[model samples]
Target: MNAHDARGSTQLLTRLFDATPSDAELQEALKAAREEYRVLRWWKLGQPAVDAIKVKLDIPQERAGSVLTELVQLHSDKLQVTVNAFPYGLPALDGVLVDVTMERQVTG
Candidate 1:
């Protein structure tokens, strides 16, 4: 995905992918992207579905699935994904849940 930054703050995903980013840098990007996803209502708990995290991250669709898998693995304790309860709605991804239960403690 040749995605430009929605905020125009240098394309995050594309640049990060093209370079040799440190794990910390990559984690930071993922964290930012995850927050953006939540704010956009794509990461809601009971919501029907959401655009894939890769879409929000501007990750190429070709690699989006893999990237998402990586994200789940890296944040295994904090993230989880399951099928959408209402396929009539999103029919794709609605189960991309984040453990906000501990968010305040971690980021507070």
Candidate 2:
């Protein structure tokens, strides 16, 4: 995938890739992408079926887990992290991994 496709800020990065982008320019686009991610926002469903990051945020399913991890770690102040447990009740998949999600931190 092209840089823009991966970043999801296609318009901003499209021009950057056409020519060599300066350090400042690249940093600027990165900042813009981060802000967009925050602005778009994400939420959780009552059931463990589908999630906002995968369906609403339009993030690829393969990357959802890692993306959630980075978002909470880097922007903890702006986000509220939660872990929901729904036991698989099976031997093979029970010990695989945990489920984690994030939502915006509400303000008064």
Candidate 3:
């Protein structure tokens, strides 16, 4: 398998071997993680526009949009710092190694 595939498999295995949490424990963990990273926006190149990040914030749909927009605008700097740190976000995955090989050739 390629390095990318291997890394994905490793992560799957790691999660599988990890102990499962109770529903209450899971909810608490999710709440903490979400609070730390308020928004997670991902996109592929050439997409028409950014996809929406959805959350059931327990507010009316009408007000949720305005609230999220205001929060993002108010904390744009902090949000950006969180986004920038996404690449190195998971410390447990630090042991995962990747080796890529390149072939140099001349094409006419």
Candidate 4:
């Protein structure tokens, strides 16, 4: 498989292996991640338009818009950081890796 395909496959497997959290916990995590993303975007991009945020995340513009909406609903508070996706190789599968970036918010 090509590098891109391998990475995507690896990501899918990783998602499957990660321990599943309760719905409430998952919601909380998503909320926190969204808030962190917004604060960082505002600081770095100056309250960028929705389309811009999507481009930065490498996700669809519509998804980015949805994320922005959710962020607004959850927390008006702002923080600074960037979320990036990277390629990680699969532990068991040979020549397979997935694109996944760590969700990190830069804080002083």
**Local accuracy of candidate 1 as per-residue lDDT tens digits, 29-65:** 8796654443323332222222123222334334445
Per-candidate Cα lDDT values, in order, are: 0.36, 0.43, 0.32, 0.35
**Residue pairs in collision within model 1:** 1-60
lDDT of 2: 0.43
Looking at model 1, residue 74 earns an lDDT score of 39
Query: What are the per-residue Cα lDDT tens digits for candidate 3 across 3-82?
Result: 33443323332233233446687689668645433332332222232112223233233344444444345333212211
Maximum-TM-score candidate: 2
Q: Candidate 4, residues 1-108: lDDT per residue as tens digits?
A: 543444432333233324344668768976866654323222112222211122233333334445544434432123222333332235632221112222223346
lDDT of 2 by residue, 1-108 (tens): 654444333322332244456779879977965654323344444343222232224333344456556545633544455653233335433221234454444578
Off by over 4 Å in 2: 1-75, 89-93, 96-99
Please report the candidate that would top lDDT against the real structure.
2
Model 3 residue 38 lDDT score: 36
TM-score of predicted structure 2: 0.26
Clashes of 2: 0
C-alpha TM-scores of all predictions: 0.24, 0.26, 0.25, 0.24
Candidate 3, residue 88: lDDT: 22
Lowest-scoring 10 consecutive residues by lDDT in candidate 4? 43-52
